[model samples]
Target chain A: MGAIKKFMYINRTAPYGSIYSLEGLEVALIGAAFDQDVSMAFVDDGVFQLKKGQDTSKSGMKNFSLAYSALGDYDITKLYVEKESLQARGLTVEDLMPLTYEDQDDDYQEKPSIRVVDSEQLADIIAEQDVLLNY
Target chain B: MLHTVNKSPFQKNSFDTSLRLSRKGSDILLIEDAVYAALKDSAIAKTVKQAVTTHSIYVLEPDLMARGLQPARLIKGIQIVGYEGFVELAVKNDKVQSWL
Candidate 1:
């Protein structure tokens, strides 16, 4: 690691409908490999990116939503879902996929990674980042 | 703020909207298909050229190359940046607003 910079990847678009969410995830993974402190924010329609039971068989698109769970494996475990975005869409955390990963530093125990936060908290996170990539 | 637009200007209003909303001195980065707007003779290019006086405009070099757009074909005064430059711009700005 040269210099670890705080990096935040913001997702505001829905997955499948556009390439932003998928491409945003790609950047998050790449940021992790660079040894930067990586965090993800799901806002607006982006909360759908974490929705459970996504089947793209008919759409002929690869269901990359499952890749959200793999974020923990990459040590990019900070996933923030905006509370207001979900409420506005009439969705709750239950509607999202339960994302967890084994904590290698803690006896390899499985633990949840997603954090449901308010817009204020999300703003703080955004302001604290050294770099923010919005998609 | 760092305003990034990845949609093609011809197909989307992101560039026009961002240009209107961005404060003077803010930076604009055109990436992905949005790189097409940097074509020297395009209408979007004319818009961007006008925007350059108030905002710093940049085109993602890799995306331009991926779309087979030569640097010489880009409008004058727009800077071309790589992924590293993308990171640098994000760090340089206080916040980022992606114009979807």
Candidate 2:
């Protein structure tokens, strides 16, 4: 395998109203298959993509929110959620669906994949990324 | 006339521009990401509060709830409206302008 580069997918748009969030998720999953170090940062309205109990039945739109749960299976486990964005939208971490991954080295112990970070921490994460894909 | 804004005040000038160009007594509805401008204690809260006196400001209830924003957290003068209310505003106004 070649040297694994860090790939960060930055999501800033809301779901349902636009196609950005869903497309970003799909691209992230496809990118994960390449075996690179993939992570996702949810900022601004992008945080809504991870909201729980999303009922699209009335809207007649596909409920793609559930697909976020499968990110762990693709080994794209690092999901960074910005605290400031959540606070601005009056959302807390509890409002989001719980996503977890299993640690292979630790007897497959389950661990949370979503990391709630402040803007400062998120800025550092963005600065460290080798490639940034914005949605 | 009814002016609708669906972009964030922090990210775009949609809210400010709509507020500026909209005539007094016009209905201003905030939906989608634009609901952020209705938040209390935000950077744009003061401006929204000021605009409330000259315009009838409304925020989409479903959009607010979808964003996990409580109605109480919104600025004092802004009214919360449902989809039906949105339709009523559209019917009441002579024209509808979306500030993209």
Q: What is the TM-score of each candidate against the true structure?
A: 0.57, 0.82
Q: Give the alpha carbon lDDT tens digit for every residue of A43-103 in model 2.
A: 9878878877666543356778889899999998899999998887657899788999997
* Candidate 2: residue A62 lDDT (0-100): 76
Q: What share of the true interface contacts does candidate 2 keep?
A: 0.07
Give candidate 2's whole-model lDDT.
0.87
Assess the local accuracy of residue B49 in candidate 2 as a C-alpha lDDT between 0 and 100: 88
Residue lDDT tens for model 1, A14-70 = 666578888999988877888878889998767767866666543356778778888
For candidate 1, the docking band is incorrect
DockQ of 1: 0.02
Candidate 2 chain A least-lDDT 10 residues: A52-61
Fnat by candidate, in order: 0.00, 0.07
Q: Which consecutive 10 residues in model 1 chain A have the weakest lDDT in total?
A: A52-61
Native-to-model Cα distance after best TM-score fit, residue B89 in candidate 1, in Å: 49
At residue B95, candidate 2 shows an lDDT of 94
